[model samples]
Target: MDVAEENSEEALLIKQHRKEKKEVQAKIQCMKNSVPKNDKKRRKQMTEDIAKLEAEVEARHKEKLEALAQKPTEPTQVSSITNGVTSLDLGSEEPVQQPRVSKAQKRREKKAAQEKERDDRIAEAEIANLSGARHLESQKLAQILAERELQIRQIPSDGHCMYRAIEHQLNEQGNSLTVANLRSQTADYMQKRAEDFLPFLTNSSTGDMYTQEEFQKYCTDIVNTPAWGGQLEIYATCVWTGGALQFCGTTGHKYREQLVLPDINCHLEDGDL
Candidate 1:
């Protein structure tokens, strides 16, 4: 066939393939909609339909590849005789060229697709929480989350968010303290006033009071390691700065604020020590 005829046939085949694929997809979607979520038998049948549709799609893709392979690569040449003189003509041959895609590019595309899928799954899980919660509590929690979204500045949860947050606040006020420096200063203050905090330092895991040696080791870990800072570090920062710290927390229905002080007589919670 001529190049034009061949191209027209390929186009028709592609259009037919697309039409068939769409019909298969529509059938699969209809089957999915007809089956109730809890209907095991109907769900099984829907699964089979999905498998069939996938196979059909794959087959149509293979047909497209076959059509491309069958396409002519050589240009047609016409010869003519004029004034009783014969002329010879050679057909032009043009090689079919396909764009080359690097493995690195493919890998990057795959990674982006996987990351998008992961984010989608996380969003779906978060939405599922609303459906699973008690109605009143769900509505309350939703409202709290909306408010928190507006007011809260999220920091990285890399075991250093608390220290980083404090560092950022200080920097905003024209102070120059790194997270590491803040942690060290807090630990030093706690160590110097161990006598005050030791009485409140109880190990929740073991249900035993912290000995002086054990408390010292805990302080060392907080300063030297990238462990997450909690109430202990908060109070230590308060004492180290010679100021009281105010903490705001919410539990869906209520917002609570507490003033953490340097005084030993202040209320000492498990984490506060």
Candidate 2:
């Protein structure tokens, strides 16, 4: 076969491999979803099967690519007569079509982009918050706390600090809940009452309302991942339990005011230290 024919064959082979891979992936997803959450033995077997199938698919794809690469390359010329004139087309080739992105892949890419943009905003906000005035503000905050006879209770600086702090307060109030329990409960509440929380939540990067899928994903991450707690989570916690979260810190020139959750009322003084 000529070089053009070889290219066409190679593209066709790649397309076939892609189709096979996609079908296998779909089957794997179905298998995962079909299994009961508590069936450890069956889940393990399904996992093994999935891994085997994925390996087989990858091997087949590799073999096809290798076979295409090993094909002999040659160029041929064909003659055509038009209007009593002979013309030779030498090694002419068609452009190889690229694989189309699936909708799921597109969604994944969009979510990743949104996350990156949100991280960038958080970094910028952090940098902006670190100012020379912070020291003075902290001293003023310390004086206020001393006046109120309240001492700062330092929680561990781990990512779960927010949850830990909440748990500590709960324990003091005779409501003992672990951090994991708190996280799961908060995530569940936010998901079930998404409408109540979704209106107040906006995309930090886009300044637009969150789509249902995005909100669901956010809730899922909170439940399944070590996602850092923020305003929405604090609000969810307050709503889940008829309690309030008092936030105190420095904003700009003044000591950042206290924020009461659920009601979202801001008080200048008398915040939880």
Candidate 3:
């Protein structure tokens, strides 16, 4: 179908025609050599006939060549009959492309990568330092608390309807005090625990800022007092608003589902006043 390939076919046909013409010439020469000298006139007449036949052959050859030349050559790039290389001039389907990744773009990418790595390293270092400090501080704090006669205690938190065991301590006399978890315990309950530290606080500000840990210590003192003996005698308990508390001791209902109210702080009762 391609013009170039068709032209090549035409060239081959021309070559084949030329070879046929040569073979015909060789046959005529053989016939002439076979005749005798005495038969000159006959030979001449025969030669004229031979010339006419050659002319007829030549005319036929030329007609065939002209027919081939007149045949329209397809402009298609590929030939269905032949698998041959063909020359061509055709438009490219692809657009001209600019080189990828400009110098400035590369620089930006590299800088961004470096910045990300730097930030990650800094974050990791800060976290490591904080963890180390917390470890040492926790160790020291544990030692200080152990100085008091501490025991584990639990408080019922309905949030976890199934009771949980928490940490705490009973004093020498047998009365116990617990730290509270503010998130789970009621706001009023947190306030009461806050007030428990008040008697030991040197100033109103200290009481206002009383920590769960601080109140816990003072409770231990009050429980151990000779006046209280094995029973805790909390004068009153008051409830206020905010903050967190850690619960202490193993918790379970006094009798599976029954409440266990022990005599302790009465601060909340005073609030009715």
Give the candidate number with the greatest TM-score: 2
User: Each model's TM-score?
Assistant: 0.44, 0.45, 0.24
Query: Residue 191 of candidate 2: its Cα lDDT?
Result: 84
Over the stretch 118-235, how does candidate 1's per-residue lDDT look in tens digits?
Answer: 5667567667765764445546645665776734465754568888888877887888989988888889988887876777778889878898889989899988876888777788
Task: Score candidate 3 by lDDT.
Answer: 0.43
* lDDT, candidate 2, at 36: 51
Per-residue lDDT tens digits of candidate 2, residues 208-242? 98999989888888877768898768877876777
Instruction: State the lDDT of candidate 3 residue by residue for 121-159, as single tens digits.
Output: 756766785667544554454444466554323333222
Leading candidate by lDDT: 2
Higher-ranked by lDDT: 2 or 3: 2
Count of backbone clashes for each model? 0, 0, 20
lDDT of 1: 0.64
Query: What is the TM-score ranking, best to worst?
Result: 2, 1, 3
Residue 25 of model 3 has an lDDT of 63
Provide the lDDT at 100 for model 1. Answer: 61
Q: Which ten contiguous residues of candidate 1 have the minimum total lDDT? A: 79-88
lDDT of 2: 0.66
